[model samples]
Each structure stands twice: as C-alpha cells, then as structure tokens.
Target: MKSEELTGNLHYQIFGLRSLYNLPDSVVKKFELHYASLPDSTIAKDTLLSVIINRKLKNSPYIFLRKKDGEVVTIYMENSQYQQFTKFKYKELIDNKQEVCIKLKAEKLMGRYYKCISVTSVKIKKGQTLGKQGKFLLYEYE
Candidate 1:
C-alpha cells in the first residue's frame, strides 16, 4: 500500500500512572536521577511527552505494535486456546479528517527537569488522499 507522512499539530496528554501501568526500565533509568528526590507518588506519574502516529494497509490481518516514532504491523496465527484475533473498523467523524501535521516540544518544569511539554498535530491544507478502501479499519489510533 502507498503511504505518506502528512503534517499535523494535534495535542495529546500522556500521563504515566504507575497504578495503571508501570514505566519501562529504560524510561525509568532515564528519569531516575532527575526525579530521585521527588516523592514516590510524584515519581509514579512520570511524564511521557510525545506523540505517535501510524497507518495500516487494507485487508491486513496484522497487529499494530506502537513505537516511539511510529507503528509496526505484525501477522500471526496461534491456537484458539492460546490466542485470538479480532477485526475492527474506523468511523470518520465530522471534526476528524484524514489530513495531518505534527510538531514536537519539550520543557523544564519547576526548574527541576526537562520533560515533554507538548505535541501538536494539525491538518494539512494540501494533504493527499490515503489509500481508499470500503471502510477504514485500523488496529488502533491512540
């Protein structure tokens, strides 16, 4: 399938709540020294300030694996007793279009450390049409 990266300035909030999900070892190590003096509760909410975007090919029976920059699609078949696969579709909304733009930003909070402060994704005025299919089926967007 043909694909291209469009420009967007969308904003997203990425909160790292330890109660819900633990931060990865690499991330923890990266920020460990910076937040060492902070309380455990505060440390638990490590800031992951970045935006990730991805696209999928039509009729693809694959799983979407998110990465720091983009996404990867993988196809696998396992025994029903061990694993399962599900299909889904995407419904475009009036406020949500296919056009996209992106910008990344980071900042230091409380003069203590630098963290991802903002990620923007805006619509592209001259955006080209993506591969068209019967329906917009994707593994995930966020």
Candidate 2:
C-alpha cells in the first residue's frame, strides 16, 4: 500500500491507568514521597485531592512507555474493523471521487507519562482507484 493512502478511521484509547503500577521501583518510590508531601486535610478533602491527582496524571498523554519490542501491538481498531465504516467503504467512496479524512485520538508514550496525540487526516491518493481491500498505517509521535 502507498504510504499516503489512508483506508479508514483511526480509533485509539489511552492506557495510562494500567501503567501506573508498571513504573520502575524508583519511580514508584518518588511518587510515594510526592503523595505524602501533600498538606494535611480532612478525609473528604484528601480523598478528593487524591482522586483529582490520579485522574489528571493518568489522563495525561504520556503513559505509553513500552516499545514494540518486535511484538505485534494492536493499538487502534483493526483494518477489518475500520473497513466497516460506510464513509471508508473503499469501493464506493474512492470510486465516486469522494475524499476521506479521519481524525483519530492517540496516545504518546513518554518515559512514564502518556500524552494525547491526534491523527489529523489520512487521505488516499486523489483519483486513485480503490477496491474492497483496505490498508493500515502505523503512526508514532514524539
């Protein structure tokens, strides 16, 4: 498949919550110290603060720290799945000269943080004929 040819919408979700426990021991120790340094407060306030911090930290787009490591990783929806979208039905849309642009939300892995990223658009070649077959594109962000 040509690099510029985008077959369908990209669907991705962040997995930051899962990585909290996966951090190195040293990182965990640092987090513990930071947690304990917070000011003393009533139980409700403390719980609220903890919840807010946890959500903020986990929702940050810097949690995908692991590399592919030669393993097949499936981050977004499969090609078969994407092909099901009517707008991306290759045979009809491409044949009719319609342009397909899909915006996808993704996550970037930075050290121990997961950052949110976006795939703005994937465009198939103009005037290029498309068949029922679809292609996949893997994107990486810094």
Candidate 3:
C-alpha cells in the first residue's frame, strides 16, 4: 500500500511491531545502546575547531591546519562555498604577519582530514574587509 494509506493503519502498526519482535536479541541490544546516546554522539560529530592556515597546497583546494603536538589536520574546501573566502582571508593574514583564528563547524572526511561545513567566525588581527563579503561564512541547515 501507499505511504498515505499506511497512516494510522492498525495492520501496518502491527506488522512493524512483529518485525521488531522478530529481530535478534543481539541486534536489539546494539540498537538500544547506539540510539540511547544519540544526543551526546551527535554533538561531537560537528566539532567547532579554531585553527589557522598552515599553508595552502599548490593547485589544490585543501588547506592544512597547523600542527599541534605533531598532529596535522587537513581542511577540505574543494566543495564548500567559502573556499575563496577562506583563501583570501588567509592570504591577508599571512601578508600582515597577523594571527588568524577561524571558528568553524567541521566533520572528519578521512584520516586527519576534515571537511569545513560552515565558518562561524573569522578573526584577523586587523581585518575589516570580511564584513563586506556577504554572508559567505554563515550557513544554516535542517
């Protein structure tokens, strides 16, 4: 039946209940533990990282995060809208010999690599030009 017909259907609800009841106990226990901590796990997935540009790779859309305690994180901007925005600001900061701190929400793409989702804040020592770059840094998703 169509999803519209399934709404408030007693038979559909019973079928779903039967399916769950037939599931293996091991699978049910795993589901319980995994879903029980969803709220906590979700919060850590989108981490807010404050980092400066280590250096921009030659002819690449990735920027490596500065090493901290020998750990280097790659920032992937290839598919993100703020690619140019990040590069421009990074160049400005480097030229002025100023510290650049960017707060962004990112998720891991691979080993020691992260895909920048949205930039929350960018702080350059003497930057004021970013205010005119539109809302390229801000992004909201459902």
lDDT of each: 0.28, 0.36, 0.38
What TM-score fits each model? 0.22, 0.23, 0.35
- Candidate 3's TM-score: 0.35
Better of 1 and 2 by lDDT: 2
* Residue-by-residue lDDT tens digits, candidate 1, 47-114: 32110101111111222222224432222112231122121112332134433343323332222222
Model 1 local distance difference test score: 0.28
Q: Write the per-residue lDDT of candidate 2 for residues 1-142, one digit (tens) a residue.
A: 1112122422222322333333567886886687777665633544433543544542222211122241212222323323323244434554686534343444422222222343445564454332223244222111
| Candidate 3 regions with alpha-carbon error over 4 angstroms | 1-60, 67-70, 78-80, 84-95, 126-142
Q: Higher-TM-score candidate among 2 and 3? A: 3
Best by lDDT: 3
lDDT tens digits by residue: candidate 3, 1-142: 1111000100000011111223567886886676566666454543332121222211224444443243445555543544434344433543675544455556664356565565566545553221113324421110
Candidates ranked by lDDT, best first? 3, 2, 1
Cα shift from native, residue 135, model 3 (Å): 37
Q: Candidate 2 regions off by >4 Å? A: 1-11, 14-19, 42-49, 52-142
True lDDT of residue 123, candidate 1: 30
